[model samples]
Target: MKAVILAGGEGCRLRPLTNHCPKPMVPILNKPVMEYSIELLKRHGITDIIMTVHYLSSSIRSHFGDGSKWGVTITYSEDGMPLGTAGSVKLAEQMLTESFLVISGDILTDFDLSAGIQHHEDQLAAATIFTKPLDLPIEYGVLLSADKKMDKMFEKPNWSDLTKHSINTGIYILDPKIFTYLEDFTHYDFSKDVFPAILKHNEKISIFEAEGYWSDIGTLATYREAQFDMLHHKVNLPSKGKEIAKGIWMEDGVTIHDDVTLKGPIYISRNTIIHEGAIVGPQTVLSESAIIHEKSEITHSILWENSYVGKSCSLGGMIGHCQIQDHSALADMNDETVNAWREYTKRDS
Candidate 1:
């Protein structure tokens, strides 16, 4: 079956990182976030795919050209303007002739798409939405289903009005017939417009309660959480590099000097250098060619490609492609300088 990947979101919450790249292209464990979704689709035997792109579309296109590397045939549908979730898929209507699956590119999940497909076919429903129970439902569109049929839907409901914690996971098995509800070149979201209209017209909308790991890394907090989850093996994400030590994964050409302490659950990408007396780890990711100088300490942080942490520096949070000079701590950097560094990193990287 063909699948539609909505990869057009601007990812405003993930500011500095998203400033240089699209949300789908955001790196997690030295790999683009959307790459995991593509891998997941491949695992479920869904190879034919269409990706909808808008903001920084070229980045994604260049990264996964034709999806050949992943053993899948991928076609891209570019939107000249912001065409909301379902609207973006409508642009590629000709390519989706049969029943198709719709998923968000920014989300990471190991959900059983095959099982969800089977559920959709067995019910013969027009659309089947994958839903998961969330402890905090205020940020997501909540759904109330009875006997697998969606009874009511609420978009980002307030705490007082919340009736259920089951929220939309932005994964859908949609029959081509559902295309009749969408219009081309318009801003229309599935949750805000299409799905609610379907319920109003009394059309069949089934809900598949997902079982397995799923995370929508929309904000900085959740993004960090997703990294930690992968490190802890909460989700079965395939490791990219070789496992040099028990919990440390390192790519080829990585240089580590003696006296450098690396705690478990850390990933150092290709050609990265960790100098002597440097301490790094415990949920940290060093992207390709990153440099951690002597006596530097990085904990629970991410260093982007080619970023430099000078000697004796200490960093705890996200560090994009920028240089932190010797004897400096992240806390010591002024807001203006940090902003300038972020801008410079975006431009240079």
Candidate 2:
């Protein structure tokens, strides 16, 4: 029972691509949206991670450093500033000594979380929040609960503080005395200051709800609708590349050129290149060494790593990290390339 992953904000609505990527290394399908919350907390076995990191904390410590390629054992609480969401879990409260799990590395949930930590140790809960049912909880903060404990909390709540629709999927399961309601340098806020100061001291916090599929990449229009809801599989990730036909995902040094006109839910990473008379995708994403030269025409795009789409560029949007050329479309490119891309950054997160 150990996981922290708050990954400190600074996504700033994904501006200029977080001005060099650090909204937990954004890029949904080609991986790294906090690597799907570290493979959903290593599929609930919870490999002892911590990861608090502020702003551009060296690109998330040079890409999950001690996480040992995802078997997980990372630590790094590094926030020298901007600590809000419960003051960044009270700055990892001395490694959260007991039952811990507080997610949000730019969210995208699968959420079983070991049945919400076995219903927070069979309701002997000290802290546990994880809720769902949000048909516009109206910009969040709802949670009411009854037998599962959490009595009331309403912040933007209305419709008479809801008879049903809850919110707060900022996931949690604390209890290391829940850090005694936090106060290290104060900016506490587990829903605007530690669950209303733990229900104003009557204490008793648990509230589970949770089922599956939650999204919060935060802006860039919900990060382009969470990468088209992971190419419409609707989140149960792990499809990096290898489909090769039905939705066309191709990985190994890919390079298609016999008059290319492929389309599908498309993803073509790892040494990508598609030249002759190109007509890419229905929801394209081509990271890892990308380049589509000839008659270009990408649709519903995203092309990050080492991208280069120049020749005949009929490109759509969000074309790659840098160097793009113009053969047409994309608001016709020229006003000094729209003032050097004044932060549209070729569209979306």
Candidate 3:
């Protein structure tokens, strides 16, 4: 079977971090977020992939190359223009001559794709969407289905009816015939355009409620939460690093001073250094080559690759590529903080 990974979204909500890197390249546990999606596809025995790339497309191409390392053959559909979701895949319509699954490269999930494909095949529908039931379906749209057939999609409907349905996961299995609904190489979204057109024509559209961990990581908060989820074993991925102790993971070349406080549920990636008197608190993630100076305290925060925290500094929230000064503190992160960081980065570079 084949798959189309939608890797083109720029992730406007996850700015500051997404400023320099593509959404798919966003690091999760020191690994590219899209890499987990590739690993998931490999586990389901779907090795042939076509990734639709835009917005720092080179980062993806340079990192994965031909995808041989993951045992998948990847061919990119590089978009010269911003071809939304459906249009991006439409660019590679010729390559998808048969049934194919479409998933967001930035999303992290351990869903059973094979089972979802089997459901789609059994139904022989025009398309099958993968969905997950939210514990509190407050913000997401509700896709109501009857006997596995899509009934109606409501945007932020009354919560009284929320428990009866599942939210769309932006994962789908589609027949090649569905391409007829999409215009050639034009920008279109599956939810806003193509699917509505299919529904207008009374074509078959099915929904499969998947059972597993699924996170879109749309915001900076969710991005950190997803990594914390991994630390807590909420989701299982064959991730990097070794768990040296309960809830504590360290990768190669990690150097920690004996006087430093090592907290559980913390992940220190390759070549990270923690100096004397530093407190590596719970839910702290230090990416590759990140350095924590003496007596610095990092709690519930994330430091991207090579970011440095100066002596006695205290921090929280996401820190992008940075060299924070000694005794500096940033406890709350908002849009203003993000813009300031971006400007700081611009000047620092």
Clashing pairs in 2: none
RMSD of 2: 16.5
Off by over 4 Å in 1: 242-246, 332-349
Per-residue alpha-carbon lDDT of candidate 2 for residues 134-166, written as tens digits (9 for 90 to 100): 777766778878887888878777687688788
Give candidate 3 regions above 4 Å deviation.
155-163, 333-349
Instruction: Using lDDT, rank the candidates from best to worst.
Output: 3, 1, 2
Q: Model 1: per-residue lDDT, tens digit, 1-349?
A: 9998999889998887898789998888889889999999999999999999999999999999999999999999999999889889889999989999999999989898999999999998888999999888889889988898998888888888777799999999988887787776788988888887787777799999999888998977677667656766678768677777777988889999999999977889998999999999766789889999999998767777888989999886654566899998774245643454354335433
Worst 10 residues of 2 by lDDT: 340-349
The clash numbers for all candidates, in the given order, read: 0, 0, 0
Candidate 2's displacement at residue 93, Å, is 14
Model 2 segments more than 4 A misplaced: 1-25, 29-80, 84-86, 89-101, 121-123, 127-171, 175-177, 186-245, 249-260, 263-276, 279-308, 312-319, 326-349
Residue 85 local lDDT, model 1 = 92
> Would you list the C-alpha lDDT of every candidate in the order shown?
0.86, 0.78, 0.86
Models sorted by TM-score, best on top: 1, 3, 2
Clashes of 2: 0
